[model samples]
Target: MHTSEHSIMVNGIPIQEDDIEYASRSLKAASHPLRLKIMCLLSQHEMTVQDIVDHVGTSQSNVSQHLAIMRDKGLLSSHRVANRVYYCLAESRRALLQACSSLR
Candidate 1:
């Protein structure tokens, strides 16, 4: 990230439309607690769907549903193994999840 990367204005009113759109999408995807946790877990290393459920203490179906949403939103990526799927962060930013962990 660069200091000028987040510049908030053309003439001081607001930034480019596309920048706002991207930021809005990113923030919205990060809005949920569970989703945030999932991202955090993935940030560390790849894990199976079951591992996420175990660490987050949620039902398999529920976790899968949440993961689906995150995947759709571009926050998570998945790969299929022989009998299971693995997941990881879409990008590498270990520190991004630190703040989320302390919130609760």
Candidate 2:
């Protein structure tokens, strides 16, 4: 990463306004313990809401709410198959997640 008079480079890529906003949102979304746990779980593999509830030991509604929040923040993405929804971390935010994990 390098810095210019007006721009910052990240891994040889120039950082832009949208990139800054996205990183900030992703960090905020993963700041919560439950949400961070969810990210850790999903980092391993995509999981259904029931699976997340079981792993997080939280109520389904609570897990669903967190999932929705993360999805809205673009830190997570979901797809439906049949009656179940599966979620995984967005590829763009995986590096942020790795940084968060190292802080643990």
Candidate 3:
């Protein structure tokens, strides 16, 4: 079979090489154990860094590092309200998370 025939497609459109690279990076960011937990938590609602640390039962510094990684990869978005920074799954990624959840 020709290599072109094996190219990945999404919604009837061929995914660009750069898009594939970006998706791979984003997926990797979410694949870590702690990050995955954080994603699942944020899937329900936005949470403050402290809230995440509490639920995940980890140090604030560790949770903050995971949050930074996911945020940098665009899997998450955050906003500040007064003194608190809240995080939620990026709008574009919500459907992806929902779909993943259904697989279990």
Candidate 4:
């Protein structure tokens, strides 16, 4: 069978409709300006909440709020190292970001 005719498997099962639902939500979350800035910052390297707030010229709580929304929508992820929380894009979205950045 052609590659297009074959199904890709995830976690020993085929991908489902719910995955598409999450992608739709993630696309919407990624459309915001501050969220884009956060993506750009993390593209360079993962960063802490304070780093994002400082660079984006927004309040820490505001940054956290945005981060939380992005996290919920499946556009980004966080890793905790001791007291610091580092955030980065979902591994799959990096190419999307590179494409978006190329427009500049």
User: Each candidate: what lDDT?
Assistant: 0.78, 0.89, 0.91, 0.86
Leading candidate by lDDT: 3
Off by over 4 Å in 4: 1-19
Q: What lDDT tens digits, residue by residue, belong to model 2 across residues 5-84?
A: 77977788888978788778778888999999999999999999999998989999999999999999988999999998
TM-score of every candidate relative to the true structure: 0.71, 0.89, 0.88, 0.77
Residue-pair clash count for candidate 2? 0
- lDDT by residue (tens digit), candidate 3, 46-99: 999999999999999999999999999999999999999999999988876887
Superior candidate under lDDT, 1 versus 3: 3
**Model 1 lDDT, full chain set:** 0.78
Score candidate 3 by TM-score against the native. Answer: 0.88
Ranking by lDDT: 3, 2, 4, 1
Rank order (by TM-score, best first): 2, 3, 4, 1
For candidate 2, give the lDDT of residue 21: 84
Clashing pairs in 1: none
Model 1: runs farther than 4 Å from truth? 1-16, 92-104
Which pairs of residues collide in candidate 4? none
Question: Residues 1-104, candidate 4, lDDT per residue (tens digit)?
Answer: 33634765767787656776776787789899999989988888889999888899989999999999988877788999999999988888887688888895
